[model samples]
Target: MQINGKTAISYHYFQRIKESLTFAATVAALLLTQLRVALIMSLVRYFKLINIFQVLFKLFTIEFGIDSSGSALDLANENIVLNELNQGKVSFVKGDATTFMKGAISENELWDLVILDPPKLAPRKKVLQSASGMYRSLNALAMQVVKPGGLLMTCSCSGAMTQSGMFLKTIQGAASMAGRKVTVLRQAGAACDHPIDPAYPEGQYLSNYLLRVA
Candidate 1:
């Protein structure tokens, strides 16, 4: 999906992540924070959790959605109401995600769960190198703010990056940079609705990883 011409990970991908989210809830059972460029994907994930994880959400979940675009935050707020979720439990922040992560780090604030779903950083093969560095930096910052033994669900929607098959290596670099040890608990691609042709690897444009940070 595209929001204002910006790529948004399809809601289908969120369906693939439901198990990961539930696992995080079982472990931390505290806070859930999502940093992303698109509002719909974030809202869709939040909506998906409502029915199956209703008890956990009502009693234990406090969500924070961080995005740089104010308009995106506004749309997320609207979706919250439309979905009939308790608005008071979900907070939307309008700020650069990296900056917000940095601030959270400095303030010694931490979350039990963090989702880093950035925009498509590498649109073409030529920029894949630079985009890898961006991913490393962003994930490094995000890892620092996750509570010890917490969960971090990081995603990449860049076809170039995903097809290159260097995502795990890039995340390993991020973990080293952040001075954090991470264990991959789950790995997934876009949902079954988005079929992938093995002959055309670019068809697999989404890569999601659920990591345990310690």
Candidate 2:
């Protein structure tokens, strides 16, 4: 029913997913789900959150671009365990996230949910401009792939980025450009383990939103 984080100072992320995704008339319709859980840095997996999807749906898929794989420490077997865990239930594919999204649109591929967790793009303030452009285009493509009334979980882990407004605007712009209206159901931030200290502004590096594409 809830996703409790690993640490003693855990956070509950169940509401984030529960609010964003809307189930269709049949519970079986939830089979085609997609969860990009947590950060997109090397396509990390928060099993605590991922299990929520497992318990609720089936025949789902996950997207992690070929470029976004592996940590410096486990270059050879970084994804082995995650892949093994999701082997039969979810399809884990490698490709360009934006490109795959656009391709899915053209191919008329749709899903019950689309989770978008991009990497920490604007790490430095100087590159925020380029990161903004990337955010717009990426969301636009994502909008095209989501089925009507489906969900979108977009996240930003760029510490330099604004804590509010900019992200919603970028996604809203994408919806406009895609000729679809996506509603903002709710907004949230880092898990408890990744807390934001009042004293250190730069310590905040995450912003997430639960959206519904209509």
User: Highest lDDT, which number?
Assistant: 1
What TM-score fits each model?
Answer: 0.75, 0.70
Per-residue lDDT for 1-214 in model 1, tens only? 2221111122312422554544332342322334112221233333333342233234334567777667666766666676676776667776678777888789987765566778889999999999999999999998888777566778888999998998999999999999999998677787666899889877889888878788
List model 2 lDDT by residue over 3-93, tens digit each. 2212111111233245433432224323234433211222334433444444433323543323344342143133435534544433444
- Residue pairs with backbone overlap in model 1: none
lDDT of 1 at 109: 75
Cα lDDT, all candidates: 0.66, 0.56
Regions of candidate 2 where Cα sits further than 4 Å from its true position: 1-44, 47-50, 56-67, 70-86
